[model samples]
Target: MSTTELSLAGSQPGGLGRYNRQAADLHYVTSRVMVYLLAFTAVSVIGFPLFWMVICSFKTSTELYQFPPAFLPHDWTLTNYRDLFIQTNFPIYFVNSLVVAGGATLLSLVVGGLGAYSLSRFKFAGMRTVSMLTLLCYMLPEVLLVIPLYLFVVDLGMADTLISLIIANTAFTLPLTMWFMRSYFNAIPASLEESAMIDGCSRFQAMRKVTLPLALPGLVSVGVFSFNHAWNEFLFALVFTSSETKKVLSLGLATWIGQDNIYSWGMLLAGAVLVTIPVVLFYLLVQRRLVVGLSEGGVKGE
Candidate 1:
């Protein structure tokens, strides 16, 4: 054979080579199919309960108790929602939850942000020990600290108040916030803040204007986490608060569960839906910032 023909023949795959290529292609396709299947299954597992909750909220009490429960409601009604608003103290619980969550989020952000900034920017004695301790505190179970926290609140004569809940939530969430924000702050260059300070801004001013703006994503992430934790917290609310007026949404919802039977599944579901909306909305609102923040952090790490 000519040299050109010989070279072309050598370059081309033989029968076994072609079969190997086919095998690789088959493997790739199978992997992709499995990945998609797993993704769909995970989404379904997580999303179905939420979907069912919303659907059942619209169901009638009679339909809710029906055997062989339907996936979708047969008789749609807003009675659950109406009763949640008019008949129950849901509005009060909602307002209390909002206040406590908001207050905790703000408090955690301020205290944790400053602490994180200090850890990131300054060299201090016991800094490593402090960081480790913070992580350990966060790792501790809520159940362990509930009694101590309740006693502390009572000692202050702040039990059964919304402020006590805020303080408790802040303390619990602060460690996580500090750890997370510290990482984010470390990812951000201190030179940026230094430059601001050199340009006539005070250290605090530089942090407020430059570092904080850059750390917006971290702040938003921790804020959302703190708010969600406080909002959904049942143990603290149950132990610390006593009065009906002081109850949060999580505590209020628990009252609907009678000893023998549920008071009203539809109304409870409706309240659950309402309780979930603010957290969802808050996440949706900050979704863009979160994506940007993650992308920026990844790029910085690289």
Candidate 2:
């Protein structure tokens, strides 16, 4: 204590404070630099594959199959894309994917939104059990459920149809939509809806007029989620629809990898680019709302 007091007394009051401030500033700067470094590293790792795919998509067949593959295209060409559209049933696949994904997203939103609202707003016996079951179903892997789903579809004689794909995708996506919307609906204050009801509006009208407007962000986020999930789904598309005309984008893309020298690598790369565009555009459109909804929902639910 005597030594400490002596040392403290020897140093100017302002000098110690200044030194401490300098150390803190140094530490903060170092931490910021480290964070930035990690972020850059992560981005580079995650983004490299997509970047390479785009690069390869532009490369000619000869350049693509080159022994020492060039990082940049030796001969850039749009031939792959031209062939993809002209030579393949890519357009049909694209439309199939769009229809299935869109239908699933729309259906998930309608059913899941109502279910979520009920779960969020109403209290009943077994509600907690039901919530847990919904989460459990979502947590289960798609592969595990596929066989039973296949048999069920077969029994219903809906196999090899777009309706089957829509039904399958909706079933899987609905639980997530319900849970996500439940969290979001929970975040929204009940007073807004109640006040509308107090103003001579029915509960349904109040929900339509007040709550739905406020839940737009959450809805957009869920829609994006459902659409993406449906778009990228391959297993169900592969197993359920064996017919060429009924195949979705993912199944169509797999055809590019032939057993012999029958397939076009360049066209496959081009297809990858084409497949990515819509999802990216959709994400960019509602990213702000998605971020807000997720953050608010996360905090409010817990």
Candidate 3:
């Protein structure tokens, strides 16, 4: 071949290689931009309502009703929160919600951890059926179960008490906790517990030391779920309790929605903001564990 032709051929190959590299770099940059855009959109969608709620809570009743609602309050005030605390029974409602949610979360974790351990470790007749039935119970509508549960509570003489609310919440949340924890337990090798037993630990001790620690993520996830559910629940709170003192945050908030009288938008918004704070704080605290737990639990189990 001629020397000029040979040089041109070599240059063409290098030029083509450069084009391919440029194309790949462009593609990577485009993908990253798209992903970031999508993430920003999602965060804005989820966070804007919360931001609005917090902002409006600080607004006066007059400002809240003004045309073309302002994004930021011109006159920031604590009157709504002050009224919620002093003029209403919101503190009592907050305490009731805390008590019920905390009790239910604790009950669910203990009972669910033990039950999940049993279902994970033991193989017996109808074990699969029992597990399926547990999930089915969770899937049952709240309205369907309310009457039966109310009747049960009445019979036990626990009606109109926080204990009834706790028991009711536990009943609803326990199944999900058991199913989720069971997956975590099944992912953990039985040999680890066996090894602990060989080292003079009792079965319960082995569980406390070996199994529970490994399953911490799952526990955090379910504890958060149970607490969130119980804290936000309104149906059971309405049906099972009648007194103002026994009311929870959800029911208490509903009282502000007047049939004949005007709604207290400021106080209502303030209550909503307060109601959301604990769940947000709890999630923020355990978010790392929650993410790991959900991913591991879903992927590792049979």
Candidate 4:
């Protein structure tokens, strides 16, 4: 063959090579389409219930009980919300939820922060075992823990109290808070705290002045997670509190549903809407920090 013909033949793609390239491109496009489809499906599944609840909250009682339920209310009204706030013990329940969730979150963060700092920065024996146990505790289901916790609360004479709810929430949340903060602390540079220590600062002062500020994103993420968890917790609240006056929103709203009686479907939906607002608002406020903190934790091998 002439040199030109030989070169041309060498440059031409083999049949297998061309087939492989086409297969890879097809696979790539198919994977992308499947990912987008799954994401859309997940959003619809999770978001539809929330959207429906809000829509029902605005519906009139007649429309709510109509033969075929309407997607959009023909007669929109705030009557449910008005009744929820005015007629029921909803306000008291809301306040109780706030106190318990807030107190639990505060206590979790304080103890978890210090515990995480110790685990990340110190070099004591059984440290690895302690870390593993913290993760195990967090991973365990609340159902498994509630029985013993209920008995403990009764022994302490704290059942049916808001403080008991707070203590219960804190006990469950503190483990996860410790795990998250431990990862975050691992990602932080130790030199920052060391420099503070060299400047006549005690260990606590170094943590307060230097380390804590650096880990603000992680702290915010953990705080929001703890608060949201406590807010949504139902089993602990149900087991701990009995009186209507002491009930949190979760337990209180549950009583609206019964075998023969639904106190008010409209008001039940309204309460659900109200229950979601604080958590959604709190998330929106610190969403950026949550994203950054979690992303950095992964990148840093935590």
On TM-score, the leading prediction is 2
Name the candidate, 2 or 3, with the larger TM-score value: 2
Q: What is the C-alpha lDDT of each candidate?
A: 0.85, 0.87, 0.87, 0.86
TM-score of each: 0.83, 0.85, 0.84, 0.82
**lDDT for each residue of candidate 3 in 143-252, tens digit (9 for 90 to 100):** 99899999999999988999999999887789878888887799899999999999999998999999989988778888998899899899999999989999999988
Error of 4 at 277 (Å): 0.6
RMSD of each: 4.8, 4.6, 5.0, 5.4
Which parts of model 4 have CA positions greater than 4 angstroms off? 1-46, 259-262, 289-302
| Residue pairs with backbone overlap in model 4 | none
What TM-score, to 2 decimals, does candidate 2 have? 0.85
Which candidate has the top score in lDDT? 2
> How many pairs collide in each candidate, listed in order?
0, 0, 0, 0
